[model samples]
Target: MMKKPGSWRQIVWLLIFTLLWGTTPAVGGLFSSLSTEKERELGEEFFLELNNNYPICTDPFVSSYINRLGHKLEAQLPPHPFKYRFYVLDDPSMNAFAVPGGYVFMNSGFIRLMDKEGELAGVLAHEISHIYARHMARMLDESKPVSIATLVGSLAAVLLGGPAAAALLVGSQAAGQAAMLKYSRDHEQEADDLGFKWLQKAGYDPRDMILAFKKLNKQRWYAGGQPPIYLSTHPHTDTRLVELANRLNMHADVLPKDHDNQEFQYFALKVDSLSGSPYQLLRRMTQAAIHEPNNPAYLYGKALALAKMDHPDEAMGALEQGLKLDPGNYFIRREMAIQYFERNRYQQALSLFQRLAQTQPHDETVLYYLGRIYQEQRQFADALSAMERVQSLNPAFVEVYQNLGTLYGEEGQLGLAHYYLGLHSLTSRALPTALFHFRKALVNLPLNDPHYARVKDQIARLEKMKVKVN
Candidate 1:
């Protein structure tokens, strides 16, 4: 069972934010008719708070997958004001939520619960619709003047399974919270309609959303001893599901349903493996493997669960058995190579990754892992070469930035090192650290370098956030 949050927690958060911002959140006014700029600014502050307080999943592959899938759906929509960013929250809550500025977060547990890529797409599409519709701003516009701190406290309360939101629902503030809830429900319906259209438009099955809702609403928290936070935030109603099902008749004859996605297994397994409670995951995957003896994903998931549980040798044993079953499985092979590296069996890892890289030169995972192996062996030149290649292949590979910074620093390239480190911090949303490193980069980088200009632009943005270089 989840612990109910005390009133003090909400009060503390409200007090802290009030002190930081020097006023209560004029929730109704500040965002009432919030311009795009103001919404973005608000989102920036909230996201910064979230990043500082929550544990964001940092697995390069997992992070990249969520962003890729999110942006893929985002591209289906017409041009928008904000650049969409997706993050995986490192929590076991079966919940997903969107912040104002085109930022959507999928909890690791939520992502793990999803069985199909289309289902995941459905979830993303819904969140995307919410952002595109500016529902938060609209809700504020509709609400009676409420403090921003009250909104934050309410959110904090909901997160804690506390009473602030429930408390607000029935008092002098009842009308405001009641109105907010009504809007929330209405917004969910609108998002479902829009998300259905967009998901189908983006070549995913519209029915996936219905399936996802039923699947989630019917589920108990798999980690056990935890409440269904998804229900608290996004209660999937029978009526809502019925309406969605009936609405599907309108698009009955749409051609060529796009339902299959090869990436789902790897993506789901990755999230499940990194879950907070690996013991539960291990047992789950182990039973799954027993049922489907040849399912590579289950075997792979089981090994990863073991690895996460600190049973490296057992994980290696499981992987070796899995590899024997399916020698050609790329996911399994890549994982085996990763295990080798983790255990300091660098030669084996290097050999395996090199061969994998030969076949997959454009694969960021293979290239990134190869680069790390090379860096570990003191092959600085090779490491830099591989890391640089990875960067050229996918500049958004955030881990590559940090590794490149380390490699370049080892090569005595301080300017490039600082620049890459700055890039890493910037992407990680560590504004102060980003500002510090970007300033250091400016001192050492030539004025004419393209990176110098990039660094300056980023520094200016950070400064706008009150993050000074000095």
Candidate 2:
């Protein structure tokens, strides 16, 4: 039958999906709404699961660029309860999707396919409109409540390739499946209309929205898996293309001026270079470099690809060349600093990260690196402070937890050390280990301690779960 859940990651997603699906009930009147708070809660949980199970891009420079662009368009809309979030998935499928409560995901493959920032802006705008309209919530409320099981099962089936899901998929009605949940033509039209208007207001050409769909219709570069995931989930692209064309013509008088996006080209190249098979990526970046030997973006791509292939020295040379071309490019500098750290050039790495921290005072990635550098230098206090800041800024950053655990243990802070180890265990899905560490932390932490409550919560959560701890 279907291949049994292909990887541990996929199996974890299946469990998460099933567990989360049970929490939100469709109990109100038909088409009645989910409270903004409930939708936000669900979206947050969903995003966290995606982070744990999927290949999400965590590159600070790229993450910052997408959020800035997504929020720029979001500002044109009237007030809503959402603090909109955008994420880039390290997937090769030419797709993007919006979930409830202002969460939108962009595929790296889709971003790489875009010709310019306008196209990406258009795509983000459309997804934003869908969230603003609460299309998914509405769909949930309108579906036959019983049919929702099929929907969950089908989506979970994508993650769990086991016989149970395979059998479930075989009998599931086409209408009850997740694919059927793709926005209908009317929903697509509404998003298109609102998206284009917002795109124009955001100083991007509305016509690029149409161009985005056209490109999707022609996209063939992907290695031919089941068709692009975008067209499946965001169906009716071919029909929407014609409609978007006429709609653009009708509003030609008020189109916004074409703004040049200096950041997009570099961002796109980074995604392409970082999110591909390393060997093939190196070849593509190298060929591009041959044609435009002085292009820093291409140089950056080559350097990154070379690093991925474990050619550290070659990577360093490419980064040096990139720095000479554009000495002020912070991303290249960031990479060079990372290279230095990996090669144990700790002094050079520390100097570079210190400069980065000054510019990006709250960047967790920069702070994380500083913490690591400090740890290597045996500056325990400094390492703890830097990593503590990172944990405060983004608790989901798994790398910091283990380091914090070690640093705290080294400094003889038994309570905090075990507490952080508990968190690290949680991230790794080691439930019994997490429970063990949390218990140890609680026993050692005094009630007056700042981390006491947090430790209690972690213990309570693990104890509540039906898990066996050896």
Candidate that scores best on TM-score: 1
TM for every model, in the order presented, reads 0.79, 0.77
The superposed Cα distance between candidate 1 and the true structure at residue 407, in angstroms, equals: 3.5
In TM-score terms, candidate 1 sits at: 0.79
lDDT tens digits, residue span 1-470, model 2:
00111354464445444433432122122223456865664465456445555667766556667877898999999988988888887766677888776788888878888978999999999999998998876775565544222334444444223233444354344225444456888898899989988998888998888888878877644445345667766778778888888888898888878778657877786777668777887788788888888888777778878887889999999888998999998778887888898789999999999998898788776788899989988999999999898877654345568999999998999999999998877765677897888889998889999989978866765564554578
Span of 10 residues, lowest total lDDT, candidate 2? 23-32
Stretches of candidate 1 off by over 4 Å are: 1-33, 140-183, 219-228, 231-236, 255-258, 381-401, 408-416, 423-433, 445-470
lDDT (tens digit, per residue) of candidate 1 on 1-470 = 11122244454554355433534212324334556876665565455445444556666667667877888898888779997778877666567777667778788777777878988999999989988998866665566655444444343334423333344334333334434532357778888888888888888888888888877776653436344665555554567799898899877888346666656787778777675567887888878877899877777888888888789998988888888888888878888988898888999998998888888776777777788888888999998998897777544345578898889999998889999999777656566788898888989999898889878876776665566544
Each model's lDDT: 0.71, 0.73
